[model samples]
Target: MNLVENLVVFAHGKESGPWGTKITHLAETARGRGFEVMSPDYSHTHDPRERVAQLLALAPTAKRLVLVGSSMGGYVSAQACATLKPQALFLMAPALYFTGWDEEPQGVPALCSVVHGWHDDIVPMERGLRFAKSNHATLHVLNSDHGLNDQLAALALLFGDFLDQVKTEIL
Candidate 1:
C-alpha cells in the first residue's frame, strides 16, 4: 500500500512573497516535524479570489493536509478549504471581513488556529477575533503589528506546537 506523505501548503500575504520571513521560519518548523511543505506564489494578482483559485489548482493531494496563511493569504486558504478539505489550518493576521471582498470567508478545517497581532493596522484584531470565535479556532493574540515580523521566533514555536497537535490528532 502506498502511503501519501503529509503536506503543508503556505499562502503568503498580499505584500509578502511565497518564501517570506514568516513562511520560511514556519516551513522549517513543519519540515522538522516530517511534513512536506509548499508555498504557492500569488504575487501575480492582488485579487483574493484569484489567489484562492491558484491555491486550489496547485495544492497536491496528501494523506494529511495542512494549510497556513497570513494576511490576505489567510482568506485564500480558508476559501480553498471548501474544496481541499485540509485536515488543519494555521492563519496569521488573516484579512477576513475586509472591504472589496464580496464573499464571506467559509470552510472550517478540523483543526484551525489563528495568530493575530493586537497592533495590526491593516487587519484589525477584532476581525481576527470574530473569525476565531465563529470558527471556534484556537487564537493567539500577540503584542505586535500586522506583519508580525517581530514575533517570528514566537511564531515558530507556536507553529511547531500546532503541527505536533495535528500529528497527534491525525494519528
Candidate 2:
C-alpha cells in the first residue's frame, strides 16, 4: 500500500511551530490515517502575505500537499490557492484577503474545507462565508472565539473529529 506522506500545517501571524492548538491534534489524528504532517514555523506576527510567494516557489516538489492554515496562515494558504493543485485545502480561521488575486481561479480542486469560529472577532465569519462561496469551499463553523487557535479550545471545537470528515472527502 502507498503511504500518504504529505501534509503542511501553517500557523497564523506571530504564531509558530506546533501552535499547541487543535490543529496539532488534528495533525495527530491524521497520522493514524497515514499522513506526515509538518507545521511550518513561519512568522505569525508579521505580514505573512509576502511569505506566500515563498511557499509557491516550492510547490512543485510536494507529493500531496494538504495546505492547512489559520488566520495569517490562511492568508498564506490563499497564495497556494493558485499555485499547487493541493489534495485538500483546509482553512481554520484563515484571513480572506489571500483570495484577492486579480484573476479568477483557474480550477478549484475537490475537498476544500474551511472551519471558522462563529464568534471570530479577527476575521468576520460573514466575510469568510462569501470567500468560501466564491471558491466553492466547504465551510465548517465552530461556536467559539479566535482562541480556538489554541489546542485546548481546538479540541473543544472538535477539530480532531473533523479530520475524519476531511479524510472521508479525500478518500
Candidate 3:
C-alpha cells in the first residue's frame, strides 16, 4: 500500500488523548503497513457531535480511508461515516445507543470490525453486539473492561489483522 494513498484516522475515547497508548500502538501498526495515520485531539469538548464535526473537518482525503475509534470516539467515527464514506471502520467499546446521542449510524462500511470488552462497565457489550449484527460487522468480544488497557497486545493483533483485511479488499 502506498503511504500517500492509504490513510488511517484514529479517534480516541472521551478521556483519552490523540496519542494515548492504544492510538500510539495502532498508529505504529498502521505506519508499518505503509499507511499514513492521524489522530485528532477532541479533548476540548465532551459533546459527541462536536467531535464528529471536528473529525469531518480535519480528516484529509485519501484513496483508501480507514476510521478507528474507541468509546465515544467510536460513535464519532461511525457518525462521520455518512460523509467520509471510509473504506473500512474499526471500533473498540463504542458508546452507541446512548440516551443523549440521537443520531445512531444508519449505515456502515462493508469492511467494518468492532472489538468490545465483555466486562465493559461503561458501554454494554450488547450494544456492540447489536451494532455489529445489524451492520454485519466482524465483532470480537474480549475478556476485558471498558479501557481494555490490559488487552493491548490482543488489540494490536486484531487491529493489524483488520488493516490487512482492508488492504486485501482494496487491492
Candidate 4:
C-alpha cells in the first residue's frame, strides 16, 4: 500500500503538547508505515473553533491530509475537517456534544470515519453516531473505553485500512 504523505493527530482532555504518548505512538506507527505526522496540543473540549484552526494550520498540503483524533480531539477534528476536505480521517471515541462544546460542525468531509466505543465513559457512543450520520461519513463502532488505548492493534489496523481505501482515490 502507498504510505500517507501527511498524517495529523489531535489530543483530548488536556494540553498534551505534541509529545503525548498516544499521539507519539500513533505518529511513530504512521512514520514506520512511511508518513509525516503532525501532533498538536489542544486543551480539553473547550474552544473547539480555535482548536480546529490549530489542527488545520499544521497541514502543509491541504487536501492530502489524514486526520486522527480521540475523544474531545475527535470532536475537534470533526468540527474542523467538516470543510477542509482532507484525504481521510479516523476518529476514536469522538464526542460531538461536550459540557462546554459550543460549535456545531456543519459536516465532516466525505473522506471521514468516526470511530466509537460502545462503552466509552468520557464520550457516549451515540454522539459519534450522530456526527457520522450528519456528515454522511462512516462510523466504526468498538466495545472499548474512551481513549481506546487498549485496542491499539485494532485502532492501528483501522487507520491503515482507511489509508488503503483512500490511497490513489479521487477524494
Work out how many backbone clashes candidate 3 has. 0
Rank order (by TM-score, best first): 3, 1, 4, 2
Model 3: lowest-lDDT 10 consecutive positions: 1-10
Worst 10 residues of 4 by lDDT: 9-18
lDDT of 2 by residue, 112-158 (tens): 66777888887888756866888788887778776565335455345
Off by over 4 Å in 3: 1-3
Q: How do the predictions measure up, each by TM-score?
A: 0.95, 0.74, 0.95, 0.80
- How much does each candidate deviate from the true structure in C-alpha RMSD? 1.5, 3.9, 2.0, 3.9
lDDT of each: 0.89, 0.62, 0.90, 0.68
Candidate 3 residue 148 C-alpha distance from true site, Å:
1.0
lDDT of 1 by residue, 1-171 (tens): 554578899999998899998899898999999999999999999999899989888856788889999999999988888888888999999998876773656678769999999999999999889988989999999999999999999999999999998888974
Q: Which ten residues in a row have the lowest lDDT in candidate 1?
A: 98-107
Clashing pairs in 3: none
Q: How displaced is residue 132 in candidate 2, in Å?
A: 1.5
Residue 47 Cα positional deviation in candidate 1, in Å, after optimal superposition? 0.7
Q: Write the per-residue lDDT of candidate 4 for residues 1-171, one digit (tens) a residue.
A: 464555555455443455665666677667665567766667543666677777667643533677777776776676666565666777877767776774567645577887777788777788888878877878888878876767777777777667666666734
For candidate 1, give the lDDT of residue 33: 95
